[model samples]
Target chain A: MKCRGLVSLLLLCAALGWVLVYSLWSIAFNPVGGSLPEQVSKAMADSGVDHPITAVLLNFRSYDTLLEIGVLVIAAIAGISMARLPSLEDPAFRTHDALLDALQRWFVPLMWLVAGYLVWAGAHQPGGAFQAGAVLAATGVLMRLGGMPMGFLQPGYLLRAGLILGFAVFLLVALVTAVVGDAFLAYPAGTAKYLILLIELFLTLSIAMVLLSLFVAAPVNDAPESQEGHQ
Target chain B: MTPDLFYAFTGLVLFITGLFGIIALQHLLRKLLAFNLMGSGTFLMLVGLAQHRNGTDPVVQALVLTGIVVAIAATALALVLIRRYYHLAGRVSLERDATDEGRP
Candidate 1:
């Protein structure tokens, strides 16, 4: 019975793939959207950033970035709430690899420097808050695996504040700009660069916090087994 | 064919493979992996299709960037949920009748 189901499912998937590929081929050959690159280049001067991706993310279509950060914060909150571990630094959970320890000693500070550079380089290049924050989070995860004490990640006021700080600040800026300027997220003349930089700074920190907290919130082996009838 | 078209077709293949994996695989973790593969395929198609028309379009690139970050967060959250489910049920797969206590 299971084999029969699998065969049917495979056949259905093959048909679906055929249809999808046909649609994509037609769409790819004949694009429908107007020349967005030309439009972006025309408005690039007023976007307050040298890099086009940065300009679109932080200036032109900032609403998407803002909501993206909001989603991260919510995910972090959910993960943290679900984490019921009594202690994060249980001795048995530590990995005592000599090579990892040695490499970590050499790599942590370098990673931090690279993350900072990425954020700073966002104004003119491909690096930005998301990339920088991911690097920072990776560093934290390495440190955690090496059994470094991360008391700040403990579920408390500090963790909560760190999780929400980026989204809060971004939303605040959007509201302030809306009230002061002509529309939401429209930075005032001459301050767009500074506003964007400030938002990106907080965004990097909060993004790292969210990712790291989610990493640390995974249930450990010591969690009590769920009783069959218990909630 | 242009590089964009090539990558777009590659992404289409990955998307279909992921779709099959998600439906045919019983393990929650495998399902999550399939979900991510689907997301990557979609991202690749978005950038490849958009840039096939306009060389190096930043708008689509930025959208993909946002998408990548969101996808990471989503995958992480899904892993957390899966881990919790495993802890509670002691099973890796979500079959209804396969909840034998010692068979994780």
Candidate 2:
């Protein structure tokens, strides 16, 4: 029976592969999309960023990035709501390893430097809020593993505010533009660079906070399981 | 066969593998991994197809970056939920009979 199942799985894989290849071939042969690269380049002067990806993310399609942050905030909220771990640092995770302690002391500051650099370099090169936030989150996770206490992540108004700060700031920018008789999220002439930089800074902080909180909020071992919602 | 097409084809294979794994695997964690594999495959396809015609499309790349961050959030949330479910149920698989057998 196991052999038969394996064979059937292989057959299914083959069938799907063939179908996908055919579709890709068809799409490649008869392309219907226009030249977006050219269009983006043409509008690059007004985007306030030298990097095309950064410009697209922060200026040309700011709404999508804004909504994406909102989604992340929602996910963090759900994570913390389900997280009733009872303490900031779980006993199971506590350790006194000298190597990890040394590593944390050495690496944490370096990671922070890299994250800041990524945000600053995003306007001209291949770095941005998302990348910086991810690095920051990784650093937080490392700190947690080394038993560093994160008191702010405790379920409180501070954690809640940090999680929503990026989304709130982005929305405020959009609304401000609209109030000033411009389209929503449209940066005014001569102020686009500063606005993008400010938004990126807040966004990096909030994104890092959201991801790190979610990581910290995961229920630890020895958590007393409840039967409240069980059938 | 350009690099773009090669990556696109590789992504197709990953997508199929992920689809099969999601269907065949019994463990919820493995299923979640498969779901992520599918997501990665889709992202690859989006970038590959866009760049196959237009050299270096940053718009799609930015969109994929957003997709990646969103995917991480989703995966993190799902993991928490799964861990909570496991704590409550004491089973990794979601089959009804498995739970019943364990309880009984």
Candidate 3:
């Protein structure tokens, strides 16, 4: 036991030491830097947002954000399908209490407000659709944890609509831009702000839905037996 | 060391720590937490690198923002999978033999 413990400790120290040395060498010798940021931020002066990060996310690097939203959607879909059968008991079945109700009343509204503000502030500040969406998703998770019925929380087709809303709008915008111009996502001059805001709004709602669905999964049942290649 | 380098080294430490935890711990939930901690460390390093003489590099900031969103999505998926595995196998650890395979 003592020998094994000493070996483990030596391994840990060696790993830490190696990481420290590598980091110091990079920081001191290489001093890594890049110019793409300054150049792009300068070139895209009319990205229609005062905030540079927002411009990059929604304007300059909108393609990446679009694909990221796609990734989120795919993950949500996969999670739902996997958890559809042979799943654990839904978190919604948990017992609720007055304390939970009080906590929801306090935190849910605050989160909603913050979500709204984050989206609105994205144009000129440090907040954006992702932050807003996360706040909303947190509320959803909170509701689920507090035992709110899934049906009441998401309703029926409305949830699905919200889930797809962001992707539809983003694709639509990209297609229209492509038809009108050479670039796929290049918005026509003087219309970037409104279009990006619209995109962000839908993205916020869809992200919230995707996240919630991923957390809760579609309620279904199958025998939770060991199956071959379950690996 | 400069503040940014200091933070970068700090991130290295944190990433290593989380990596260690993920390899050492048996519980899936704790491994998930460690993975998240590693992500947080990476984010911190990105922020540190983005810190410039004037301000942060917007490109890095944007990338990190996107990363944060993606991380949550990943976490949600991992959590659901973990929960499913736990329910199906009757244990949280990923050890193959311990997960009901020994039952007749």
Candidate 4:
């Protein structure tokens, strides 16, 4: 036992040492940096694209954002389908715990209020659709844990609408822009910020609903062992 | 040290810690948490790299933002799979017998 413990200690020390060395090397030799070529910077300056990060995400790499949204949509749909609780099974799953029941009485409304604030805050700050959605999902999880009836949640229609809302709104805005003679997804300079904010708001609501549905759909074997034995 | 350097170092530490946690933890949920930690570390690194005198790189921020969404989607799927497995098997850990395909 002593020898084994000593060996494990030595291995841990070695691993820690290696990690330290790697961290130092990575920090010192970051490959992302290079002096911007004068022509490139000049062109960017001429085009008035001041923020390189914005230019890359919004212009040079917008396709990645589009794909990411698509993935989110797919995941939400899959989660909802998997977690669909039939009306018959819903009543059987309701919780009888008094303590949980009491706590949820106060917590549910509070969570919704907070989630709304988080969604609104996303427009001008670090809070956005993702954060707000996660918060709302947590509330849903809380409700489920409290033994609230699944039928009250309106799981199907709410989820379907949410899954489509963000992408649809974003596409609609882009289409409008295109119709007005701008390139696809390119908003007029003054309106771009507002447009992005609008898209983000929808995105957050959709994301929250999707996440909540995913969490709630975590499978539980409601079937009794007697039924399984007979089968 | 510069703020950029500070953020970079913090991110590096977070990444390493998350790597260690991913390797050491037995629970799938813990592994997911570690993965998220690693992602946050990467985000920090990206943001740190973008911090410049003129301004930060919008492209990297946007890319990272997009990556965050994708990660969550993948995570949601994995969680669903985990939940399903747990429900069916009554255990989360993979057993040696299962690992050995048809040995039994």
DockQ of 2: 0.67
For model 1, residues A1-231, the per-residue Cα lDDT tens digits are 879999999999899989988888888778576799899999989988899999999999999999999999999888877776765445666788898999999999999999999999999998999999999999999998987777777657887788888999999999999998889999998898999999999999999999998888887764354643166
How would you class the docking of model 3? Answer: acceptable
TM-scores, all models, native as reference: 0.93, 0.92, 0.82, 0.67
Candidate 3, residue A37: the lDDT equals 67
Interface alpha-carbon RMSD, every candidate: 1.5, 1.7, 3.7, 4.8
Query: lDDT tens string, model 4, B14-97?
Result: 876677667655566777888888888878766665553224545556667777867877788888876655555655555534
State the displacement of the C-alpha of residue A82, model 4, in Å, after optimal TM-score superposition: 3.8
Model 2 alpha-carbon miss at residue A92, Å? 6.7
- Candidate order by DockQ, decreasing, is 1, 2, 3, 4
Candidate 3 global TM-score: 0.82
User: Could you tell which candidate, 2 or 3, scores higher by TM-score?
Assistant: 2
- When summed lDDT is taken over every stretch of 10 residues in candidate 1 chain A, the lowest stretch is A221-230
Task: After superposing candidate 4 on the true structure, give the runs of residues whose Cα lies further than 4 Å from its correct spot.
Answer: A1-66, A84-89, A96-110, A149-155, A222-231, B2-7, B13-34, B49-66, B89-104
TM-score of chain B of each: 0.91, 0.90, 0.84, 0.81
**Evaluation by lDDT, superior candidate among 2 and 3:** 2
Q: TM-score-based ranking, best first?
A: 1, 2, 3, 4
RMSD of each: 2.3, 3.0, 4.6, 6.4
Off by over 4 Å in 1: A31-33, A87-92, A95-99, A223-231, B97-104
